[model samples]
Each structure stands twice: as C-alpha cells, then as structure tokens.
Target: MTSPLHTTRRAFTWMLGTALVGGASACGLSGTGGRGVIFRMGLRTAKAPGEESPGEFTTDTGWRIRLSSGVMVLGPIYIFENASPLEPTASAPRVLQRLGQWLLPTAHAHDGHFFSGGTVLGEWDREVVFDLLEEAGEVRELGRSPGIAGLARSFSLLLQPPSRALGAEGAALGGRSMILEGTASRQETHVPFRMALDFPPPVELQRVDFVPIAAELDEGGRFVVEVQPHRWFDGAHFDRVTVPEGGGVVDLTPDTQVYRALTLNVRRYTAFAGTWEPA
Candidate 1:
C-alpha cells in the first residue's frame, strides 16, 4: 500500500509538467512565426486639390501665399490594430457593442482601454527631418522596420524637434519642430513672413494621434505619409500680421493671430494623410 502524501506529491508533479508543456506549445504557436513581415516607410508633401502650384495657394481669408521654404521634423510613428471611433465603421451600434463588452466582468480584466489604442502592429521610433518643399513632388524613404501582419486601422506620430545627428536639417530647425518662410499678399499689402514653431516646456511630445488609415499590412509593404503645408494656413489672418517698417520679412511670434492659427491647423488631422503601397 502507498502512503497518501507520496501519492499527492506525484499527482502535483504530473500536473505541473502538463501545464508547462501546454504553455510552451501556446507560445510556439503565437510567438515564433507571427511577426515576420517587413515594411518600408516614406514621407512626402503635396499640393491639395485645386492648387496649381506646389507652394502657392490662396488662403480662405483671401491671402495669396507663396512659401519659399518649409521644413518639419516628424517621427516615432506607430501603427495600431484598431480604428479610431471617429472612423466610418464606428457607428451607434459599434458604440453599444463596445459598451456591452465593457460591462462584462472579464472585460475590465484586460490591459488597455475598451475604446482607443489597440495593439501596436508596427513602429518606427526614429526622428526624421524632411524639407517640405524638396519632397513636394518626390518621396523620401525613411528606413524600414519589422511589423506583424494585421489590418492597420490608424497611426500616430510625434512632432518633436529633430535629433542633433540630423546635422544641417537639425540646425535649420534651430531647436524648433517646424519653420516656414513665405510671403502673403492681399490687394496692395504684401507681408513676407518667417514662422518658427516649437512646443515649449510642459508639452514634451506633440503627438498627433488616431489619424484614420486602412492598410492590410503584409510582406513588402510601404507606408507613405503625405503632408499638406498649404492647409496649415487655412484660418490664418494675414491682415492681423504687423508689417515691419522698411519692408523686411516679418518674424511671426507666438502671440500673433496668424501664428496661433497655423499652430492649431498644423496638428489637425485634415492636414495629413497616410497610404500603403507595395514595395
């Protein structure tokens, strides 16, 4: 006859071995071969529809503006598996469905929220500085990164200053995230303006999040981000700009109305769009 304690110890050992084997099998099935896709990424700027010239457009306030130079620092892009609630698919029914899921006892047990920021499918955490005027009709490749195969529903990126390693591009920014040199004219008034924008203290990362995009990310895919610089001046009141005496280019300070408008418009979702292409 066997002792009861010895038999119980043996049973415990067998159960532990079975659990370890099951865990290993699950890991092998989900981890080893799931994230094998590689994606290339690029950035560029383009003229919005109805604009005949690359850097010249008429603002809504009747100011004909021509940008002589434009540069911006953008990076640390992240692609997510879930779409934003503002997207077309997020209707009244979808909200109710998510509410039902949230009501479940097991729903709150998961990591992340019920509505926003789903699993990260891919990321490029490098800061890149690109010339908006130079990339107007061309695409500049911003290195590749590994990604998992999934439906990329939305993406986000940071609009911080360029790294010092970016050399001249970084220096041109002068610790600012964006700089634009342009001249705006309305009737008899012409004002040449230089706008330098930077996010100051307490505002570390100027993240533009949840820009809706749909992409079936698979092998050899390329993600392209298109920026519309003209749209940045949509609500700008150029008439409010103080013209310097003797006709020098006016430097737009943070207090100016036009500068404030540009700052807000630059971060708007309509100013940027994303698309995926085959590599």
Candidate 2:
C-alpha cells in the first residue's frame, strides 16, 4: 500500500492537474466584454450525510454570488462558504467528485447555446451535453473518445445547432432589472446527474433589478459589469451573464460546494460599476 505521505503527494499532484484541466483559464476562457451589469444573487444547495441509490447522495447549502459582466462573457473570480466533502472514499466521491466536475469544466455557455464538459479523466466516464438557443434540433449527445483529455480536447467535434434560434424575441430590459425568456427542451445533465442541489421553495424565474450599478466602456467598446454582494456565500456566489456585446461570462467567486441539483438557476444584478472586491 502507498504511504499516507505518498498518497497525499499524489493527491496534491492530481489536484494540480485537475485544476489545470478544469480551471477557467485552461481553455483560453475569459469574461465577456460590454457595459458590465453587476448583480447580487442568492443561492442554496442541499446535501445529506447518508447515501441514496447508486451514484447518488444528498447535501444542502446556500450562497449569495456577486457577479460582474462584460458584453458577452462572465467570469466568477471568487467564491465563498460553499460546501463539499473533503475527500473521496471507496463508496463514492458523489459530492466531492461532482463538485470536482463543476469546478473542473462542467458547463460553458457561448454565443447563445451551452456546451458541457463532462469528463476530466479522459474516457473513463466522459460525456458532453448541448443546449441550444432555439427549439428545433433534438438535444445532441456525444460519447467521449479514448484518453483522459479527449473530452476536453475533442470539444469542437460535438457540434449541433440549438433546437431554437436565439433571438431578442422576448428579451426585455428595464431600469435595473431585465428578463429574457427561453426554453431548454432537452433534459440536461448540467447539474443533477452526479449530485442534488436544493434551493428554497417558490422557486421561479422572473425579472429582477440590481440597483446601484454602473457600466464602464473600454477601448473595445466592451463593458465590465461589477457589483458587491449585499449578502453571499461565505459572501460569494457563481454567476452567469449575457454581455450586450454578444457572448456571456461565468463570474466565479471563491466557493465551496454544499450540494447539487437541476432546475435551479442562481442569478445576480448590480446597480453601480467599479472593480469588484471583497466587502
């Protein structure tokens, strides 16, 4: 058997590689550009100590995400008071493994559609799911090729049009609040396949206004939306935003995983624009 010290060393090395393969920068990923729209968002997740059926578990936690935006891309630079198991054991790595995947590269939205990176260990158990901005094509699924980095590397190969064309159709904006209504007809493994995240009841998506916000236009005419959370997970949260310019950004704050789930969308909005920091 490997010594504990050796095991720790291996874990550390593995984690480092994991961070590289799954981190935000690995894929030349960056925030979008625009007149940044910032928001203070509240989020909650559920978890439990005992095991459920195979490949499942329960957990519970919540957080508030402070998000900044560019026209199209959002990058979550911080996270706070999230929750997840510290290590993986024989029974399963359910929570930790899933958290690993999320923090790794589970979902990324671009142009209007969403692409998911499902496996980091090559072909051991890798998959990718796509969500389109329209309502025509069926959900496309691609099996990963052999290799630990195949899924991440072969990302471009799995391409399909969004079932519906993404448009400004019902998208509307107000003073500090805005709403864009769209549908994802296919079942996505974006959140729940590996874990269950629970939020408060009366969960519904609606228009919300983030006050005290501002927008700073850059030389490229891109805006970097910034905000400070009124409240957040350990005072932080993960946020996704659509940049007026075109793409979107996933504003990641320093966070820990408490649980996981599907059918829940956490969001944030800001009133004033400035460089964001811990408040």
Candidate 3:
C-alpha cells in the first residue's frame, strides 16, 4: 500500500470511466463496478512531521515564523500514458481533448526534457485554485473521473498567478495571484509578513515524476494529489527576510533572495506530486 501523503494537489482533476488500450481515448472509460476515481487535493506545510497541529517555530536564523495564509494558483493537470517514461520517444505532451478543440505541443525539447515520447492520458478542463494554508481537512474534492488506463509515470501542470491558468469553473481569484502571509518575530517583537507572488503568463511543469502504476477502480479506492508547501520554503532564510516599518514583509517581493528560495523549493519538490493507492 502507498502511504497516504498529508497534502493533495493544487492543479486540475478528471473523472475518467474506464481503461485505455490501443485506439482508446482516455475519456472513453467504460468500467463497471466502480465509482470512478476521486482526487482529494490539499496542501501540506513544513511543520514538524508527526506533529498533530502546525505550530509557530523559530527558523535557523532565530526568527520565529508563523503562517497565516498560503495560497497557490495551479492547474490544467495532465496525466501521461507513458508507462516506461525512462525511454525517450518522439511524442510531445498534448491536449488529449478539449470541449471542441485539440492542442498538441509542436516543440520537441522543453527545458531539456523530451515530451515527444509521452502520451497524454487525460485532462481536467478546470484548474484547481486554492489556498495552501487552509485547514487541511477542508481541502476540496478536485475531480471524480472514471477508471483510468495505463500506469502513468509522469504528471504535469502549470504553476501560475491567478491571471493565467484560468479555472474553467469561473471561481478563480478575481485579481489577486498567490498569497503567502505570516508573522515573523525578532527579539520578541512580532512583524507581519505577506508575499503575493503573481507572475504573469504562467510557470509550467512539463513533467512531475511519480510512482508508475496503472490504476483500477476499487470500491473504496481514491487518488490523492498532495502539494507540500513545506517543500516550497526549502532553504528559505527568515533572517534574510525584510519587514516593513509597521507591517508587512518585503521578502514577498520577487526581487528578493528569500523569494528565490521559495520558487526554487517548489520546483525541486514538484516531482512528488502524487501517487495512486488501492484499498
């Protein structure tokens, strides 16, 4: 059994019905005796593992960091049919289907990764936009698709500001992008800090590696997508973080090294996006 991760995903979702074989469309799921697949997407933080509740902590630089809100805009999730992702192929990532449109990547190499060798298993038309710092138990159900075919080896999606990666649900952020806010204390004095990361266009993760396994519809089975924010703050130094005179933190600005740490951490941790488990 794959041990369940504490957090889920900040991306797209689908509800495929059956398996995919030769000449089969990912949407052509027609399985029996299953309620399809339901993805429980949520966020996880850098709190000490096994700790029942997240707690304020002093960073390595002796600054106390307390999180208040953590939001992330992500989506347009894609699952690949690349069972043997280790081998390079001539197939690039593609949009298996759209409401009435079809899109495929014409470019061959992206950031040095070869997408031309993979098959798109399915896609969630709507992007999932949520606050990563919300109560984990309140995380939403991203999608409930039918049974999926092939043991997917890679998952991909985009990390963007609310401006891009529009959610088909029409429930995305009105104008704000991402909100990462908290309280930092130095010398027993508390300072408020908030970082709103809003990069226009969008940051795309072509491939997020995960365990390869063809999933089946088990009566009690569910697919979970976890986005661990703790990983995103990896190597971030709170002492280097700057705060305003009365309130707010300047480290939220994109130009700061503290901001760079957050981005680098997210990229490094994307590979552990998720895994399918059985009952």
Clashes of 1: 0
Off by over 4 Å in 3: 1-48, 54-64, 81-117, 137-139, 163-174, 185-191, 202-220, 245-251, 277-279
Candidate 1 per-residue lDDT over residues 180-240, each given as its tens digit = 9999999999999999998542222265656679887778989888887877888889888
What lDDT score is found at residue 213 in candidate 3?
A: 38
Q: TM per model?
A: 0.76, 0.17, 0.60
Question: How do the residues 1-279 of candidate 3 rate in per-residue lDDT, one tens digit apiece?
Answer: 221221123321211112222214423454432223433332333344544434355554566567777666666555555443332334643332221111232223333233432544444444556655565433355655433444456555555545344554223455544567787677866666667665343233322332233544343344555665544554566566556666655546777766777655554423235555555
Q: Against the true structure, what is every candidate's RMSD?
A: 12.8, 22.1, 11.2
Model 1 TM-score is 0.76
Q: Which residue runs does candidate 2 get wrong by more than 4 Å? A: 1-163, 166-204, 216-220, 226-265, 268-279
Better of 1 and 2 by lDDT: 1
Q: What is the model-wide C-alpha lDDT for candidate 2?
A: 0.22
Number of the candidate with higher lDDT, 2 or 3: 3
Q: Rank the candidates by TM-score, best first.
A: 1, 3, 2
